[model samples]
Target chain A: MAEAVIEAKGLVKKYGELEAVRGIDLQVAPGEIFGFLGPNGAGKSTTISMLCTLLSPTAGTARVAGIDVVHDPARVRQKIGLVFQDPSLDDQLTGRENLEFHAFIYSVPAEVRRARIDQMLELLQLTDRASSQVRTYSGGMKRRLEIARGMLHEPQILFLDEPTLGLDPQTRRNIWTHLNDLRSRTGITIFMTTHYMDEAEYCDRIAIIDRGQIVALGTPDQLKAMVGGDVVTMTSTQLDAAAEEIEKSFRVTPTRVDGTLRMEVPDGKKFVPRLVRELTVPVDTISLRRPSLDDVFLKLTGRAIRDEEAGDRDRMRQMASRWMGRRR
Target chain B: MSVETATKPMAADLTIPVDTRAASLRAIYIIWYRDILRYWRDRWRLVASLAQPLLFLIVFGSGLSSSLGSGTLFGARGGLSYIQFMYPGIIGMSILFTAIFGAMSIVWDREFGFLKEVLVAPIDRWAVAVGKALGGTTQAMIQGLILLVLAPFVGVKLSVLTVLAIIPLAAVLAFGLASFGVMLASMMKSLQGFQVVMNFLMMPMFFLSGALFPLTGLPGWMTVLTRLDPASYGIDPLRRVVLSDSGLSSAVVDRLGLTINGHVLPIPLEVGVMLAFGVVLLGIAVVMFQRRD
Candidate 1:
């Protein structure tokens, strides 16, 4: 087994009256891609902030590249590169200048800086746009430039916070391909926080966090096995009542998702016949599929991955209270 | 076959880590250089800073020149033209104004998150502060030099040697004031608060510095207040340097029998005082920066 290059124990961060991160422990091994999977406001950014030395943890300890983050952040920063959720490059500078500026800050030697800049431009396919101002680049190009800049100093570990958050699916896939190639070529450990299940699938292992706590941590296969059954989905004109009847007849949990009835069962194919007969309403369409990461999150959290209402309401109230306090 | 092929490519790809301190300093130089480059590129900003002092020199100095012609008025030495005397004061005033307003860039950086990026870098915190101070002081120094070059055009005679001496003095004052400006920028936290402090503190300091009028023209209390003002101290020695041929001994015996050099000496007390102020303000700014959110 590879040794862990990044480790955290009982890491906690508080923002006055609120506890943003609550005693989360994490370990990321060398040459491994570790994903922090969480919904918005699940303290993923907060944890990354403390680990990256952007914010001082309120309590607990984290070590990146064997250096304690709180006690020796400067050393930790020297070893770990960070690409924040927002692109931090200066719009006034060209892509090459941005990388050069970061290389200088990391104290990269001139010859190496030039070589690395050339290599990264080729790697990111940005040679043509290297001299173009960042503000002129497309979103994907900017993100790729930022990633290249982050790796300019050849840090041992790289932290990418929601790297593909707002990108289109095609762009996200393209970035993922570049990221995978980078890891395989350089053997650099990558720590990423993302809400997208497909993004998490690209990681070797992932930690599912909710409410400032890691609910589960394992490989995607292991996590999918945790749900313990094939997901049987049915589409009916009256999904609500049919789902209710199907749940009553079988000892399976049926969840109403987007005009469809989804239930997990060990023998979905075998149970389909019984389900159709037992259902009071007619099923227009029925299908059995393998469990996905969304199903795993739903099974673990007892709510769908995209539970917009509860999360949005909580976020709105938090924002409103913050606004009121600021006014006061 | 595999071993030889792989080894060659891997060796070519492998890179040794190089020392980065020199690069960091170079980056800081670039940052400072960029500030000057930007100032030159933005002709309007240059024009505004230069025009402000030139207007004061042209209108105020000319208006007061005839009244105080070549004489010992208000304890000034005899044979000094009012334009020559007022020129250094205006230069000092320009330095103070430029230094203080240079801090507005910090506020802009914070709002735009450029400051955050700089803070997150592996460089030393003191380097960030010092780099910013150097950038601001460089801008102010350039403006001061521009005013000096334009001195003859404004009816003030200044030798090249005096101009050379005035550069370092203006730099010291600019850095000192810029350090204070940084402290204010870090403490205020908001643009509105900074604007209020700039108007309240900076404007009063300039007016009370005797940059516009001779310190002796004011009442006894006002003169005492001017003595306590750092800007007043700054302008005194600079004025004496520019108007040195007027037979004025830079040192004066105060009422308390204390001998003080206003500007005649090679190194003026104003430079020392401003240096001390810069150190104190820089110390405070560093502390404030560490504690910033």
Candidate 2:
């Protein structure tokens, strides 16, 4: 097995009474694409911040690239590249200028700085637009440029926070392709967070966090396997009656969720035909499908991953209190 | 396999460079360079910042000089033009405005997310504060130098010695004001919020620093306020250096010099206080940033 480039043991971050990231442990191996999957306010970003040394953990310890983040943050910073959740590019600067400035900050050798920047620009397919101001680029181009800038210093590990947050499907796919290419070429460890389950499919391993704690951890297939079978879902006018009939006939308990009868079976396709024929209550619709990350998340957290603005106020309140805590 | 072969050699030797003193200095230089690049690119900003100060110098100076000239302000028995006195204050005003606005860009950077990029870099947090202070100080000093070209027209002395003295003197004041700007901007998250607070404090600080009026013959309350203002020291020395060598009477020079409890502030003391203020304010800014994300 490859060695772990990132290790966190019982890491915790609390703001007043709110534990944004409760005790959690993580170990990401070198060259592994590790995914942190969670819904909004699930402490994904907070964990990233602690690992990146942008925020101090209230308790526990973390090491990035074999350096303790809190003890030697500068060294960790040198070893890792971070692309923040927000757009951190200087809009006033051209792509090349931004990379040049970043290279200077990282103390890349003067002899190789120019060639390295050129190589990064070419790798990101931004060689032509390298001279154009970032303000004029499309969102995808800007994202690609930011990734390029992050990689300019040749860090051993790269942390990307919501790498594909607000891009189109094509751009998102392009980004994943670029990330995959970079991984294959450089073998640099990648730790990224995203609410998008589809994006998590690209990871070698996934950890599902919810309400500041990890609820599940494994590869995409392993996570789905934990659901144990295909998901058979049925909507009926008499959902309670249907659920009882399914349990009686199939000897499997069916969960009633939001006016639907849902059950996990070894072979949902075969069971659906039997279920339709055997059910006593009038079933309106029935469907059988493979378990997805969304279903895994739903089963674990009892909720679907949604783009929620309702939690924004709560998150802001948590941030304000965190800022106040830092002052002390 | 072909792609890995092409890139692996370059990526394989990932050197973990320690963050030494030289790296910190390099960080400062890079950050300073970025600020300078932005300033140079936005030529309109430099032009626009000069407009308000020029208005104060030309329109306000001429308007006030006509009314206040014959009144023996600062004990000018030989009828020294009020513009000569107002020129130094205008220079101070330019420094205050440029320095504060330069500092306000920090709020803009924070809002735009660039501040986070700098904060997360491997360098010392103090480097960011120091680089920002130097950037703003340099920008404000440039504005002051531009304004100095108009000094002769306003009846202030313009000699080799005077020019040599004013540049560093203005730079010292610029450093103090810029450091003050960085301190206030460090706590702010939004440009609108920073602007609101800056406007509230800036106008009062300029007015109370004896930049627009003589400190002598003031009421006890105003005297206390002026004496307490650090900008007062900055402005006094600048005004003294010009007036003392402008062939003004010793009596008039004594009246124009800044005094606290009837003792005049020496030029060296004034410069020293400004330098100390710069250092302390920068220290506070660095501490504040170290605590922030």
Candidate 3:
């Protein structure tokens, strides 16, 4: 097995009385793509902040790239590269200038820095627009430039906090391609977080965090398997009656949420037809699909990952982005 | 995707040793260089910075000079012009504004998330604090120098010796103000908060610094406020040196210069007080930045 590049033992972070991250214990092997999959306000960002040595853990301990994050944060910072969820590029500077400044501050050797800057620009396919100020770049280009800057120093472990958040699907795919290319070429350990379930499918392993705690951890398939089998979701005006009828007729347990009845079956496609025909109560809608990260979250937490209760997290994300915007 | 085989050679690549002191110095240099580069790129800022100080020198000075007449204004000679006395004060105001606003870049950086970029780097946080302080100081001093070019027009005599003397004096004032600005900005969470606080603090400090008038004839309570103001110490020595070669009579010069309890504060001691303020504030800024980050 590869050595763990990042390891934590019950790490916790508190902002006064609010516990943002609570007892998150995990490990990432060197050169693996590790994803902290969670919805907003699930403590994903707070965990990344602690591991990246930006915020000290209020309790417990963490080691990134073999250095204790608290005992020696500088060493951890040296070994890790962080691509913030919020864009950290100086909009006033050109793409090349931004990379050059990062190179200098990271103390990359002068001779090596010049070559690395060119190499990064080319690798990220940003050579053509490298001379333009960052404010002129499109959102995708700006994100690519930020990633390029983060990788310029060749850090052993890279922490990306929702690298593709708020991006369109096409742009998100482009960023993923770039990230995959970089990972293939450098073999650096990539640690990232995202609320998007499909994005987590690309990770070698994932930890599902919610409400400041890790509820599940495994490869995507393993997590899905934990949900037992395929999922059938049905909605009816009388969800309780529909659920009771489906359970009694199909010999499968069903959970009622809102006006919907959800159940895991051996084969959702095979079972959905029977469920609709045999249900005594009229069904408004019925759908069947493979168990996903969302299903895994539902099974574990008894609530949809992106439930309406996420208003606080949405507000917090907005505040953070607005604060970041106001600085410029 | 077990990557152990792919990671073996990476161990060799990651171990490139670095000299800690040299790396720390390099970080400071890069931060300082980045600041100067940004300032250079913003031509409008440089131009706009001159407007307020010049307005004070031309509009305010001219308006007050006509009203007060050519008699002693601050204790200078009977012939010493109001424009001349206000020249050093105007320069002092320029330095104060430039330095304080220059440090405001921190608040901007924080809001923009650029502060996180710098803070997350491996270098010492103190290096960042000191580099920023020096960057603001250098820019502020340059603004003062630009204002100095108008010295002859204002009837303040200038020679090579006096010009050379003004450099250190202006630098002391700039550094002190820059450090104070950084200290205040370090504790600020938002640019709006910083602006509100600056608006509250700046006018009083500039007014109490005795920049527009002499410190000698202020009321008892105002005298204490002036003495407590660090800019007061900075402005007094700057006025004394810049006007010493203005050909003012000794009696009028004595009358116009800064005095406390019937004793004139020596130039070196005043410079020392400003230096102390600069160092102490800079130390505080470093502490605040380190703690916050």
Candidate 4:
């Protein structure tokens, strides 16, 4: 078995009364791409921050590159590179200057710094824009530059916290391509947190997080297998009462997705006969499809990830209001 | 996904050995050098620093000198030209302001995540603090010197020898102020909070330091306040050097106590005191920063 490059045991973080990260345990092996899948406010960023030594855990321990993050954070930082959700590059600096600045901060040798800067520029396809200031670069270009800066030190482990969070779909795919190339060429372990289901599919292993805890951990196929079969989604005018009746007769769990009722059965086509006969209300439309990451998320959390996201937004608003009241 | 293997070389071929300690020092130098380069590129910032002190000299020196009529308005010190008396005070004020503002950049750095990058690096946190303090002090000194060059143009005359002698004193003062600013920066969490403190605390400290006028002119209560001010200690020696024909006095007998001769020894006692202040402030800043993580 490969050695673990990053590990966290019962990591917890709290902000006053609110527990941001309730106890999460994770392990990423060397040369592996481990994706942390969660909706907003699911403690994904908090966990990553603790592991990277940017924030100390309230209770628990983490180790990165064999160094105890809490005991010796500086040592862990030396061996790990972090790409924050926000582009942290200085806006006033040119692309080349930014890499040079990062090289200095990481302490690469003078002789190696120049050559590495050249290699990074070429690798990120930023050679033409190297002389231009970062403020002028597009979003995709800025993200690419941030990635280049993170790798300048050649750390053993790289932590990307939603690296492509706000980028266009085309730019996100480009970032994924580069990420794959980087892992293959350098053989470095990658620990990334992403909300996008398709992005999670690219990882060798994924941990689905909800409400500050990991609900499931496995490969995509393994996670899908847990649901038992294909998912059948039916939209009805009376979904509230009909969903309960369908569940009773079908002997399968049915979750409400927006205004639709969804259920997973061994064979959706064959099960449709029983579902229609058992339903007390008329169905407006019916659709059958294979199980998806969204279905797995809903099955594990008992609510769709979208609903959890909205719940978090409301919680954040309440927290903000309390803080402002205290200030006044 | 295609697991396309590279035909070039294995991991063994790319392995290169390095000394960890040496690498960390190199990283610190990079952070320091970049700060210096940024200062150099911002010509307007440099101009503004020089202009502030000159404005004081041109506006305050001329207006106050004419009103005070070149006599000993304070009644405690010897009769001297107002322009000569206020030159050193302005220089001290310039040094103090520049140092404090220079350290204020830490707030910007923190907000932008630049400070976090340095804090998480392999090197000691003290090294980062030291680098920042050194950079801020150096910038303050350069700005102070530029004002010193414009002194004669603003009607404050001084011999080249006197100017040379005062540069070292200005540098010492700059280092002390910069260290204090770093200590404050580490304590304050946000840019807005720090700015408010700077305006409320730092501005009053400068004005009450007797930077623009002698302590004797103020009311009795204000005079006592000035004695307790650290900026007073800084400006007193500098004023002595600029106004007196004997260069600067080593001692002065006053009602409060005997002001020891700052110029008597090989290195002035004031310089030693300022150095001690810098060391203490720097120690506090480093301890605070390390404890924060």
lDDT of 3 by residue, B115-221 (tens): 88898888878888888888889888999889888987898888899889999999999999999888988878786686576667888899989799888877899
Q: Model 1, A24-61: lDDT tens per residue?
A: 99899999999999787889988998899888888898
Provide the fnat value for model 2, as a fraction from 0 to 1.
Answer: 0.77
For residue B49, model 1's alpha carbon misses the true position, in angstroms, by: 3.1
Clash pairs for candidate 2: none
User: What's the ranking of the predictions by TM-score, best on top?
Assistant: 3, 2, 4, 1
For each candidate, the alpha-carbon lDDT, in order, equals 0.77, 0.85, 0.85, 0.76
Candidate 1 CAPRI level = acceptable
Off by over 4 Å in 1: A15-17, A56-59, A235-240, A258-260, A267-278, A284-289, A307-328, B1-31, B37-44, B57-86, B245-267
TM-score against native, each model:
0.84, 0.89, 0.90, 0.85
Tens-digit lDDT track of model 1 for B48-92: 777878787778877777666434543344434566666777888
Error of 2 at B184 (Å): 2.4
Give the better candidate number (1 or 2) by lDDT: 2
Tens digits of per-residue lDDT for model 3, A1-328:
5789899999999979999998999989988999998878789988998998877899999989888989888777878888998878999989999999899789888989989999999999999999988889999999999898888888889899988877889999999998888899999999999988889998999999989999999999999999878988888888888777777778999987666778999877779888777778898998888898988988898877663444457667678767673332
Top-DockQ structure, candidate number = 2
Per-residue alpha-carbon lDDT of model 4 for B85-192, expressed as tens digits?
Answer: 667778888888888778767777876666766666667677677777777787778777766666556445578787777778777878888888888888876665
Residue B172, model 1, lDDT: 86
At residue A233, candidate 3 shows an lDDT of 85
Between candidates 3 and 4, the lDDT winner: 3
lDDT of 2 by residue, A58-174 (tens): 999998887898988878888888887778899999999999889988888889999999999999999999988899999989899989989989998889998887788899999
